[model samples]
Target: MYAIVNIAGQQFKIEQGQEIFVHRLDGEEGAAVEFDQVLLVDQDGKVNVGTPVVEGAKVNGKILAHVRGDKVKVFKKKRRKGYQKETGHRQDLSKILIEKITF
Candidate 1:
Protein backbone atom coordinates (compact mmCIF):
# COMPACT_ATOMS: atom_id res chain seq x y z
CA MET A 1 0.00 0.00 0.00
CA TYR A 2 1.02 3.59 -0.57
CA ALA A 3 -0.18 6.90 0.77
CA ILE A 4 0.13 10.57 0.02
CA VAL A 5 0.60 12.50 3.23
CA ASN A 6 1.33 15.99 4.39
CA ILE A 7 4.41 16.59 6.51
CA ALA A 8 5.93 19.91 7.38
CA GLY A 9 3.84 21.75 4.83
CA GLN A 10 4.78 19.41 2.01
CA GLN A 11 3.07 16.48 0.37
CA PHE A 12 4.79 13.15 -0.12
CA LYS A 13 3.89 9.82 -1.64
CA ILE A 14 5.19 7.16 0.75
CA GLU A 15 5.17 3.43 1.16
CA GLN A 16 6.23 1.01 3.83
CA GLY A 17 10.01 0.72 4.29
CA GLN A 18 10.57 3.76 2.10
CA GLU A 19 12.90 6.46 3.31
CA ILE A 20 12.37 10.13 2.61
CA PHE A 21 13.80 13.52 3.51
CA VAL A 22 11.55 16.30 4.72
CA HIS A 23 11.79 19.66 6.42
CA ARG A 24 13.15 19.32 9.95
CA LEU A 25 10.84 17.83 12.56
CA ASP A 26 10.93 17.88 16.33
CA GLY A 27 11.96 14.96 18.60
CA GLU A 28 15.18 12.98 18.69
CA GLU A 29 16.74 10.56 16.28
CA GLY A 30 14.89 7.25 16.10
CA ALA A 31 11.80 8.90 17.41
CA ALA A 32 8.44 7.62 16.24
CA VAL A 33 6.19 10.06 14.41
CA GLU A 34 2.65 9.87 13.17
CA PHE A 35 1.30 11.94 10.32
CA ASP A 36 -2.48 12.22 10.24
CA GLN A 37 -2.82 14.37 7.17
CA VAL A 38 -3.19 11.55 4.74
CA LEU A 39 -4.60 12.85 1.53
CA LEU A 40 -4.93 9.60 -0.30
CA VAL A 41 -4.16 5.92 -0.12
CA ASP A 42 -3.95 3.11 -2.63
CA GLN A 43 -4.38 -0.45 -1.60
CA ASP A 44 -3.80 -2.88 -4.45
CA GLY A 45 -5.32 -0.57 -7.05
CA LYS A 46 -8.30 0.46 -4.92
CA VAL A 47 -7.93 4.11 -3.91
CA ASN A 48 -9.28 6.21 -1.06
CA VAL A 49 -9.07 9.96 -1.37
CA GLY A 50 -9.75 12.36 1.45
CA THR A 51 -11.78 15.52 1.63
CA PRO A 52 -8.74 17.50 2.77
CA VAL A 53 -7.62 14.51 4.80
CA VAL A 54 -8.80 11.00 5.36
CA GLU A 55 -10.33 10.53 8.75
CA GLY A 56 -8.69 7.84 10.89
CA ALA A 57 -5.92 7.46 8.33
CA LYS A 58 -2.35 7.82 9.44
CA VAL A 59 1.19 7.29 8.25
CA ASN A 60 3.67 6.09 10.83
CA GLY A 61 7.39 6.67 10.50
CA LYS A 62 10.64 6.72 12.37
CA ILE A 63 13.04 9.59 12.41
CA LEU A 64 16.33 8.14 11.24
CA ALA A 65 18.51 11.27 11.44
CA HIS A 66 18.74 15.00 11.20
CA VAL A 67 20.82 16.61 8.48
CA ARG A 68 21.36 19.72 6.42
CA GLY A 69 20.93 20.16 2.71
CA ASP A 70 23.65 21.46 0.42
CA LYS A 71 24.26 25.15 0.63
CA VAL A 72 22.62 27.40 -1.94
CA LYS A 73 24.57 30.45 -2.97
CA VAL A 74 22.98 33.71 -4.08
CA PHE A 75 24.98 36.48 -5.69
CA LYS A 76 23.89 39.91 -6.84
CA LYS A 77 25.85 42.55 -8.73
CA LYS A 78 25.11 45.98 -10.08
CA ARG A 79 27.13 47.23 -13.02
CA ARG A 80 28.91 50.60 -12.86
CA LYS A 81 27.50 51.20 -9.37
CA GLY A 82 30.07 48.74 -7.98
CA TYR A 83 27.56 47.03 -5.75
CA GLN A 84 27.69 43.35 -4.99
CA LYS A 85 26.15 40.97 -2.48
CA GLU A 86 26.49 37.31 -1.73
CA THR A 87 24.60 34.93 0.55
CA GLY A 88 24.30 31.25 1.19
CA HIS A 89 21.82 29.02 2.98
CA ARG A 90 21.30 25.41 3.90
CA GLN A 91 17.96 23.83 4.79
CA ASP A 92 17.52 21.74 7.88
CA LEU A 93 16.09 18.33 7.10
CA SER A 94 15.12 15.05 8.68
CA LYS A 95 15.37 11.56 7.27
CA ILE A 96 12.46 9.30 8.05
CA LEU A 97 11.59 5.71 7.36
CA ILE A 98 7.99 4.89 6.65
CA GLU A 99 6.89 2.09 8.90
CA LYS A 100 3.22 1.72 8.12
CA ILE A 101 0.06 3.29 6.80
CA THR A 102 -3.25 2.55 8.45
CA PHE A 103 -6.79 3.66 8.00
Candidate 2:
Protein backbone atom coordinates (compact mmCIF):
# COMPACT_ATOMS: atom_id res chain seq x y z
CA MET A 1 0.00 0.00 0.00
CA TYR A 2 1.02 3.59 -0.58
CA ALA A 3 -0.22 7.05 0.30
CA ILE A 4 0.12 10.69 -0.62
CA VAL A 5 0.50 12.67 2.57
CA ASN A 6 1.00 16.28 3.45
CA ILE A 7 3.72 17.32 5.87
CA ALA A 8 4.73 20.86 6.65
CA GLY A 9 2.76 22.17 3.66
CA GLN A 10 4.45 19.78 1.27
CA GLN A 11 2.94 16.72 -0.32
CA PHE A 12 4.87 13.49 -0.63
CA LYS A 13 4.16 10.09 -2.10
CA ILE A 14 5.37 7.53 0.38
CA GLU A 15 5.41 3.82 0.97
CA GLN A 16 6.38 1.52 3.77
CA GLY A 17 10.10 1.31 4.59
CA GLN A 18 10.89 4.28 2.38
CA GLU A 19 13.01 7.11 3.70
CA ILE A 20 12.30 10.67 2.65
CA PHE A 21 13.78 14.02 3.54
CA VAL A 22 11.32 16.79 4.22
CA HIS A 23 11.13 20.19 5.88
CA ARG A 24 12.35 20.06 9.45
CA LEU A 25 9.89 18.93 12.12
CA ASP A 26 10.03 19.55 15.83
CA GLY A 27 10.88 16.15 17.26
CA GLU A 28 13.79 14.02 18.30
CA GLU A 29 15.24 11.25 16.24
CA GLY A 30 13.33 7.96 16.36
CA ALA A 31 10.11 9.70 17.32
CA ALA A 32 6.88 8.60 15.73
CA VAL A 33 4.65 11.01 13.86
CA GLU A 34 1.29 10.71 12.16
CA PHE A 35 0.19 12.70 9.20
CA ASP A 36 -3.59 13.03 9.03
CA GLN A 37 -3.66 14.96 5.80
CA VAL A 38 -3.68 11.99 3.50
CA LEU A 39 -4.77 13.04 0.06
CA LEU A 40 -4.74 9.67 -1.66
CA VAL A 41 -4.34 6.02 -0.82
CA ASP A 42 -3.94 2.93 -2.95
CA GLN A 43 -4.20 -0.62 -1.80
CA ASP A 44 -4.67 -3.86 -3.67
CA GLY A 45 -5.49 -2.16 -6.94
CA LYS A 46 -8.15 0.03 -5.36
CA VAL A 47 -7.62 3.73 -4.89
CA ASN A 48 -9.30 6.29 -2.67
CA VAL A 49 -8.91 10.00 -3.18
CA GLY A 50 -10.17 12.89 -1.08
CA THR A 51 -11.39 16.32 -2.06
CA PRO A 52 -8.69 17.77 0.16
CA VAL A 53 -7.84 15.05 2.54
CA VAL A 54 -9.22 11.61 3.24
CA GLU A 55 -11.28 11.27 6.34
CA GLY A 56 -10.12 8.68 8.86
CA ALA A 57 -6.90 8.19 6.95
CA LYS A 58 -3.41 8.70 8.23
CA VAL A 59 0.22 7.98 7.46
CA ASN A 60 2.66 6.94 10.13
CA GLY A 61 6.36 7.67 10.01
CA LYS A 62 9.45 7.57 12.18
CA ILE A 63 11.90 10.41 12.31
CA LEU A 64 15.32 9.04 11.48
CA ALA A 65 17.46 12.15 11.66
CA HIS A 66 17.61 15.90 11.32
CA VAL A 67 20.02 17.44 8.87
CA ARG A 68 20.73 20.25 6.46
CA GLY A 69 20.71 20.27 2.72
CA ASP A 70 23.47 21.40 0.37
CA LYS A 71 24.20 25.07 0.19
CA VAL A 72 22.62 27.05 -2.60
CA LYS A 73 24.24 30.24 -3.79
CA VAL A 74 22.38 33.32 -4.91
CA PHE A 75 24.20 36.00 -6.82
CA LYS A 76 23.04 39.31 -8.20
CA LYS A 77 24.91 41.73 -10.44
CA LYS A 78 24.21 45.02 -12.11
CA ARG A 79 25.81 45.74 -15.46
CA ARG A 80 28.16 48.77 -15.60
CA LYS A 81 27.20 49.66 -12.02
CA GLY A 82 29.91 47.62 -10.19
CA TYR A 83 27.15 46.43 -7.87
CA GLN A 84 27.09 42.79 -6.86
CA LYS A 85 25.61 40.72 -4.12
CA GLU A 86 26.13 37.09 -3.14
CA THR A 87 24.33 34.90 -0.64
CA GLY A 88 24.14 31.24 0.26
CA HIS A 89 21.52 29.18 1.99
CA ARG A 90 21.05 25.71 3.35
CA GLN A 91 17.63 24.38 4.32
CA ASP A 92 16.97 22.40 7.42
CA LEU A 93 15.47 18.99 6.83
CA SER A 94 14.40 15.83 8.55
CA LYS A 95 14.63 12.27 7.40
CA ILE A 96 11.62 10.12 8.05
CA LEU A 97 10.96 6.48 7.41
CA ILE A 98 7.45 5.58 6.35
CA GLU A 99 6.04 2.90 8.61
CA LYS A 100 2.42 2.42 7.67
CA ILE A 101 -0.72 3.87 6.16
CA THR A 102 -4.10 3.45 7.78
CA PHE A 103 -7.55 4.36 6.64
Candidate 3:
Protein backbone atom coordinates (compact mmCIF):
# COMPACT_ATOMS: atom_id res chain seq x y z
CA MET A 1 0.00 0.00 0.00
CA TYR A 2 1.02 3.58 -0.52
CA ALA A 3 -0.14 6.93 0.76
CA ILE A 4 0.14 10.64 0.12
CA VAL A 5 0.70 12.44 3.37
CA ASN A 6 1.46 15.93 4.56
CA ILE A 7 4.56 16.29 6.65
CA ALA A 8 5.94 19.58 7.82
CA GLY A 9 3.67 21.38 5.39
CA GLN A 10 4.97 19.38 2.46
CA GLN A 11 3.18 16.57 0.70
CA PHE A 12 5.01 13.33 0.06
CA LYS A 13 4.09 10.06 -1.59
CA ILE A 14 5.31 7.32 0.67
CA GLU A 15 5.21 3.60 1.06
CA GLN A 16 6.01 1.15 3.78
CA GLY A 17 9.73 0.59 4.51
CA GLN A 18 10.60 3.69 2.50
CA GLU A 19 12.74 6.47 3.81
CA ILE A 20 12.29 10.12 2.89
CA PHE A 21 13.87 13.39 3.78
CA VAL A 22 11.54 16.20 4.73
CA HIS A 23 11.71 19.61 6.35
CA ARG A 24 13.22 19.60 9.82
CA LEU A 25 10.89 18.23 12.46
CA ASP A 26 10.72 18.78 16.20
CA GLY A 27 11.95 15.48 17.51
CA GLU A 28 15.13 13.67 18.32
CA GLU A 29 16.61 10.92 16.21
CA GLY A 30 14.94 7.54 16.65
CA ALA A 31 11.73 9.12 17.87
CA ALA A 32 8.37 8.02 16.61
CA VAL A 33 6.02 10.41 14.84
CA GLU A 34 2.57 10.15 13.37
CA PHE A 35 1.11 12.17 10.55
CA ASP A 36 -2.65 12.43 10.38
CA GLN A 37 -2.92 14.50 7.24
CA VAL A 38 -3.23 11.67 4.80
CA LEU A 39 -4.63 12.94 1.53
CA LEU A 40 -4.89 9.67 -0.33
CA VAL A 41 -4.18 5.97 -0.06
CA ASP A 42 -4.07 3.10 -2.44
CA GLN A 43 -4.17 -0.52 -1.40
CA ASP A 44 -3.81 -2.92 -4.28
CA GLY A 45 -6.61 -1.82 -6.63
CA LYS A 46 -8.62 0.00 -4.01
CA VAL A 47 -8.28 3.73 -3.45
CA ASN A 48 -9.42 6.07 -0.71
CA VAL A 49 -9.36 9.83 -1.00
CA GLY A 50 -10.25 12.35 1.63
CA THR A 51 -12.14 15.58 1.81
CA PRO A 52 -9.13 17.81 2.49
CA VAL A 53 -7.74 14.80 4.29
CA VAL A 54 -8.82 11.24 4.88
CA GLU A 55 -10.67 10.84 8.12
CA GLY A 56 -9.36 8.14 10.47
CA ALA A 57 -6.28 7.72 8.35
CA LYS A 58 -2.74 8.15 9.58
CA VAL A 59 0.88 7.53 8.63
CA ASN A 60 3.47 6.47 11.10
CA GLY A 61 7.19 7.00 10.73
CA LYS A 62 10.37 6.96 12.70
CA ILE A 63 12.94 9.72 12.76
CA LEU A 64 16.15 8.16 11.59
CA ALA A 65 18.38 11.20 11.46
CA HIS A 66 18.65 14.96 11.30
CA VAL A 67 20.71 16.42 8.50
CA ARG A 68 21.25 19.37 6.22
CA GLY A 69 20.70 19.50 2.52
CA ASP A 70 23.17 20.63 -0.10
CA LYS A 71 24.09 24.28 -0.24
CA VAL A 72 22.61 26.45 -2.97
CA LYS A 73 24.35 29.58 -4.23
CA VAL A 74 22.58 32.69 -5.39
CA PHE A 75 24.34 35.35 -7.35
CA LYS A 76 22.98 38.61 -8.72
CA LYS A 77 24.70 41.25 -10.81
CA LYS A 78 23.77 44.39 -12.66
CA ARG A 79 25.68 45.42 -15.69
CA ARG A 80 27.31 48.87 -15.60
CA LYS A 81 25.91 49.45 -12.11
CA GLY A 82 28.84 47.94 -10.17
CA TYR A 83 26.35 46.03 -8.02
CA GLN A 84 26.81 42.40 -7.18
CA LYS A 85 25.54 40.03 -4.55
CA GLU A 86 26.21 36.43 -3.59
CA THR A 87 24.61 34.17 -1.07
CA GLY A 88 24.22 30.55 -0.19
CA HIS A 89 21.73 28.47 1.74
CA ARG A 90 21.14 24.98 2.95
CA GLN A 91 17.92 23.51 4.26
CA ASP A 92 17.59 21.56 7.48
CA LEU A 93 15.98 18.21 6.97
CA SER A 94 15.00 15.07 8.78
CA LYS A 95 15.17 11.51 7.51
CA ILE A 96 12.08 9.52 8.27
CA LEU A 97 11.34 5.85 7.78
CA ILE A 98 7.74 5.09 6.93
CA GLU A 99 6.57 2.16 8.98
CA LYS A 100 2.89 1.83 8.24
CA ILE A 101 -0.31 3.48 7.09
CA THR A 102 -3.58 2.73 8.82
CA PHE A 103 -7.12 3.90 8.56
Candidate 4:
Protein backbone atom coordinates (compact mmCIF):
# COMPACT_ATOMS: atom_id res chain seq x y z
CA MET A 1 0.00 0.00 0.00
CA TYR A 2 0.97 3.60 -0.52
CA ALA A 3 -0.08 6.82 1.16
CA ILE A 4 0.16 10.53 0.68
CA VAL A 5 1.17 12.22 3.89
CA ASN A 6 2.27 15.56 5.19
CA ILE A 7 5.61 15.96 6.91
CA ALA A 8 7.27 19.19 7.92
CA GLY A 9 4.95 21.27 5.79
CA GLN A 10 5.52 19.14 2.73
CA GLN A 11 3.54 16.37 1.09
CA PHE A 12 5.05 13.01 0.29
CA LYS A 13 3.98 9.75 -1.23
CA ILE A 14 5.19 6.95 0.98
CA GLU A 15 5.14 3.19 0.92
CA GLN A 16 6.18 0.46 3.25
CA GLY A 17 9.95 -0.07 3.50
CA GLN A 18 10.64 3.14 1.59
CA GLU A 19 13.19 5.70 2.67
CA ILE A 20 13.14 9.45 2.10
CA PHE A 21 14.73 12.69 3.29
CA VAL A 22 12.66 15.47 4.73
CA HIS A 23 13.21 18.84 6.38
CA ARG A 24 14.93 18.39 9.74
CA LEU A 25 12.80 16.70 12.34
CA ASP A 26 13.22 16.03 16.04
CA GLY A 27 14.42 12.58 17.11
CA GLU A 28 17.67 10.63 17.03
CA GLU A 29 18.83 7.75 14.95
CA GLY A 30 16.71 4.60 15.38
CA ALA A 31 13.94 6.66 16.91
CA ALA A 32 10.42 6.13 15.71
CA VAL A 33 8.02 8.71 14.28
CA GLU A 34 4.42 8.73 13.19
CA PHE A 35 2.67 11.07 10.78
CA ASP A 36 -1.08 11.45 11.09
CA GLN A 37 -1.78 13.86 8.28
CA VAL A 38 -2.51 11.21 5.77
CA LEU A 39 -4.33 12.68 2.79
CA LEU A 40 -4.85 9.58 0.78
CA VAL A 41 -4.10 5.89 0.62
CA ASP A 42 -4.15 3.23 -2.07
CA GLN A 43 -4.20 -0.44 -1.34
CA ASP A 44 -4.12 -2.73 -4.32
CA GLY A 45 -6.00 -0.27 -6.51
CA LYS A 46 -8.50 0.57 -3.79
CA VAL A 47 -8.23 4.25 -3.01
CA ASN A 48 -9.29 6.27 0.02
CA VAL A 49 -9.12 10.02 0.35
CA GLY A 50 -9.97 12.30 3.21
CA THR A 51 -11.20 15.77 3.84
CA PRO A 52 -7.92 17.47 4.80
CA VAL A 53 -6.85 14.26 6.42
CA VAL A 54 -8.02 10.70 6.79
CA GLU A 55 -9.32 9.91 10.22
CA GLY A 56 -7.58 7.01 11.92
CA ALA A 57 -5.00 6.89 9.14
CA LYS A 58 -1.36 7.20 9.99
CA VAL A 59 2.13 6.68 8.62
CA ASN A 60 4.80 5.12 10.78
CA GLY A 61 8.51 5.47 10.26
CA LYS A 62 11.91 5.12 11.84
CA ILE A 63 14.61 7.74 11.94
CA LEU A 64 17.50 6.11 10.20
CA ALA A 65 19.88 9.06 10.63
CA HIS A 66 20.19 12.79 10.67
CA VAL A 67 21.79 14.15 7.52
CA ARG A 68 22.78 17.31 5.70
CA GLY A 69 21.83 18.03 2.14
CA ASP A 70 24.32 19.20 -0.51
CA LYS A 71 25.59 22.74 -0.28
CA VAL A 72 23.94 25.43 -2.40
CA LYS A 73 25.88 28.44 -3.56
CA VAL A 74 24.26 31.86 -3.98
CA PHE A 75 26.08 34.62 -5.76
CA LYS A 76 25.00 38.19 -6.41
CA LYS A 77 26.80 40.80 -8.44
CA LYS A 78 26.08 44.42 -9.28
CA ARG A 79 27.17 45.90 -12.57
CA ARG A 80 29.51 48.98 -12.40
CA LYS A 81 29.23 48.93 -8.62
CA GLY A 82 32.16 46.62 -7.95
CA TYR A 83 29.93 44.82 -5.42
CA GLN A 84 29.93 41.04 -5.26
CA LYS A 85 28.57 38.64 -2.70
CA GLU A 86 28.65 34.91 -2.38
CA THR A 87 26.97 32.64 0.11
CA GLY A 88 26.61 28.91 0.62
CA HIS A 89 23.98 26.94 2.44
CA ARG A 90 23.15 23.37 3.34
CA GLN A 91 19.71 22.41 4.59
CA ASP A 92 19.34 20.25 7.65
CA LEU A 93 17.62 16.99 6.84
CA SER A 94 16.45 13.76 8.36
CA LYS A 95 16.46 10.34 6.75
CA ILE A 96 13.41 8.30 7.55
CA LEU A 97 12.41 4.79 6.71
CA ILE A 98 8.72 4.09 6.27
CA GLU A 99 7.57 1.10 8.23
CA LYS A 100 3.81 0.99 7.89
CA ILE A 101 0.64 2.76 6.79
CA THR A 102 -2.53 1.95 8.63
CA PHE A 103 -6.05 3.21 8.49
Q: Against the true structure, whose lDDT is highest?
A: 1
The deviation in Å at residue 29 for candidate 3 is 0.3
Candidate 1, run of 10 with poorest lDDT: 52-61
| Model 1 lDDT tens row, 1-103 | 9999999999999999999999999999999999999999999999999998999999899999999999999999999999999999999999999999999
Which scores higher on lDDT, 2 or 4?
4
lDDT of each: 0.96, 0.94, 0.96, 0.96
Candidate 4 per-residue C-alpha lDDT over 45-92 given as tens digits, one digit per residue, 9 for 90 to 100: 999999989899989999999999999999999999999999999999
The superposed Cα distance between candidate 3 and the true structure at residue 36, in angstroms, equals 0.4
**Candidate 4: segments with Cα more than 4 A from true spot:** none
C-alpha TM-score for every candidate: 0.96, 0.96, 0.97, 0.97
Candidate 2 at 4: error in angstroms? 0.8
Q: Residues 1-103, candidate 2, lDDT per residue (tens digit)?
A: 8889989999999988999999999999999998999999999889999988889998889999999999999999999999999999999999999988899
Clashing pairs in 3: none
Q: Measured by C-alpha RMSD in angstroms, how accurate is candidate 3? A: 0.7
RMSD of 2: 0.8
Per-residue lDDT of 20 in model 1: 99
Lowest lDDT 10-residue stretch of candidate 2: 51-60
Model 3 lDDT tens row, 2-94: 999998888999999999999999999999999999999999979999999999999989999999999999999999999999999999999
Model 3, C-alpha of 98: deviation from truth (Å):
0.3
